[model samples]
Target: MVNYALGNNVITQIGLLVHDIEKTSRAYADFFGVDKPQWFWTDEAEKAKTEHRGKPTEARAKLAFFNMGSLQLELIEPDRNPSTWRESLDSNGEGFHHIAFVIEGMKEKISLLEAGGMPLLQKGEYTGGRYAYMDTFKDLKLLIELLEKDR
Candidate 1:
């Protein structure tokens, strides 16, 4: 078996880009017979320390999460700012964005992926952890996200 560079390959989350998060989330909740999950904006750039294409950016998005067994579905509505989310939405017209895996060794994992041709596209810190989006679409057919929660 091939050893994965980022450790466990279990996908914990699937993200979708949407134009209207409220409408999309409500539709999903109704379709699944579940209550609409609350949506919130990502932390400000000051707190999140967001970077896109290696430069600091103030880009942010409205996000809502739905728990589906061991995996999560995330809806993202990006603001009119430069970010991986916005770029994908504008280019692809709102659809599946990325699959995420919880990981450790953020720097090492990023380096490995980059060296392997999956260059880092964006990165940012959240409340308890950090996340990086890798440009893996060309090889994997979807962007890959690495999430590392503080231990």
Candidate 2:
């Protein structure tokens, strides 16, 4: 498995970049025999809280999620440019993007990782949570997304 962590827990989500979220998500769910996927968009105003490279970016995407036992598989369809998803898709095509771990003390963890040379590539908010994506692809072969939920 891709080795990364949040606090003490292992990475728990498998994220992917996709050209078509609904199609890819349904295909993945069907292939994995999982339940229907949950959907979300990143375009809504007053979204959780977000920053891209230490600045606010209007990056957006359509996302679909599937729960398979202990991991959530995510498919992202890029809806805006100047975002990580777009970059990944543009550079690498459709495939694995990042793996995530939801944990406490998110900002602190991000700081530690950033201080250690892993730059913060992208960050954004969801309904009740926030997330930061660290550029760990060189070391881990995949981006690392750190999630912090306030519920």
Candidate 3:
């Protein structure tokens, strides 16, 4: 039942696409009794190497993160770019975007997921890690994000 070779099913982050991050972040912070999450713009340094749909893109977004034990809540305010966040917002409006699983052996996992017909939709790296979004909404009913952490 559980294919361990494909990696563990641990969802470390729940990403949400929001129309207004400041309000959402404040709401979540108050609801969870936590301080407001620090926001980061993806375009501070060099543009993140990413792809949307099937073409290379420079899509950007402002992100706010809140840690809940081992799990994290990510609020994404997409900029005027062709990123997945923007696309998801356009198609579904403000709501869940992707569930991320942090695990090892990402190449193998990516291969396994790809073999299952889930094509890679977007990808970008930060710090010493990388993440990839898979187009699995049709079958899985939700987008899946695979994160490989180096720290």
The most accurate candidate by TM-score is 1
In model 1, which residue pairs have backbone atoms overlapping below 3 Å?
none
* Model 1 lDDT tens row, 19-56: 99999999999999999999999999999999999999
Candidate 1 at residue 92, lDDT? 94
lDDT-based ranking, best first? 1, 3, 2
- Cα lDDT, model 1, residue 146: 96
What are the runs in model 2 whose C-alpha is more than 4 Å off?
A: 1-5, 43-45
lDDT of 2 by residue, 22-41 (tens): 77877877787776677788
Q: In model 3, which range of ten residues has the least summed lDDT?
A: 1-10
Best candidate, lDDT: 1
Give the C-alpha miss distance for residue 19 in model 2, angstroms: 0.6
- Backbone clashes for every candidate come to 0, 0, 0
- Could you tell me how far off, in angstroms, the CA of residue 119 lies in candidate 1 after the best superposition? 0.5
